[model samples]
Target: MEISMSTIAFGFIGFKATDFAAWDSLDYISKHRDQGEWTGLYIAEDEATAKGYLSDKINNSGNGIAYLHKVSVIRPGKLITCLDQSFKTGNIDIPALKQAMRDKGINVEDTDKLTEKLGQLGYYFRCFNNEDGAIEMIIPVELVTNVDMQLYKTCIAKSFVFSCQ
Candidate 1:
């Protein structure tokens, strides 16, 4: 009973809102803020690494199963709009930051505009504080085939067999 591991590019997609209406409403941003569920795709090097991270960081109270998909060989493109350590000190100036990004040719006036642009490109925008206490806003573009249900089932079955042994 040996578990096989490979260095695969994995993608984890999470939903901001439960329904499409809530996601598309004018107050969608506020909803996400209030619910604290604006997370996007998290890429990991392999299944084991992703499982460990997701179990610790994502699977709250052991109630949720992490959705991990084997992505294509093409690495997802990352567009880092902001990386500010001042946010850790609670000195974030929103307007000034937006102007700065505009000056940097990012073409984004606000978070909403950034989300819209990313959505149009079939990508997801996520903002969070990195481990070093820096505010990071990133857009992860998913450039791969859709999840193969049969393959996923086979992988799960093999994992179960290996674990039970």
Candidate 2:
């Protein structure tokens, strides 16, 4: 397929990481290595960006079916959420923010710390309703190709196809 800048859009780089959830212990990586491609989907702008993102993981100390998925749009919908995962991971400094709260005489704990404490108190993944506060993205996302890990790492594609409908 003849690749174009417009044709190549959103891509997701699959990776391995131990601390996928806030409840996971900090020592989790040391105690037990991740067994497979982690559940969290790290989305990138395109194939090149995905390659750059996954380059370090290729030679890392674990083996799994690493992938770069070219997601083509079948239909688009507004993905509305109160917490955008990307924003939290990219912008927020959870530890520093927690410290700032404590400094202000408000005994604040990190989400992980709070989650752990709450778990001990028999509370799990609690939710509360909020009005008029939301974040939404209309991303057309249907996997177009499971672009080979080798192709992505080596920066060459011999037999990968992309189809957008």
Predicted structure with the largest lDDT when compared to the true one: 1
Q: What TM-score does each of the candidates earn?
A: 0.37, 0.26
Which ten residues in a row are the worst by lDDT in model 1?
A: 147-156
Clashing pairs in 2: none
Model 1: clashing residue pairs? none
Global lDDT scores for all candidate models: 0.35, 0.29
Can you give the lDDT of residue 69 in candidate 1?
Answer: 38
What's the CA RMSD for each of the models?
A: 11.7, 15.3
What TM-score does candidate 1 get on C-alpha atoms?
0.37
Cα lDDT tens digits, model 2, 1-165, are: 010111222333231211112222223323433322121123443444444443343333433223444433232221212242333334434466346435644344665353233222222121111222222111211111122122222222223222211
In model 2, the runs with Cα more than 4 Å from the true position are: 1-39, 61-67, 80-89, 93-165
Show how many residue pairs clash in every candidate, following the order shown.
Answer: 0, 0
Query: Candidate 1: where is the Cα deviation over 4 Å?
Result: 1-39, 42-53, 56-78, 86-92, 118-129, 133-137, 140-165
Q: Looking at candidate 1, what is the lDDT of residue 136?
A: 33
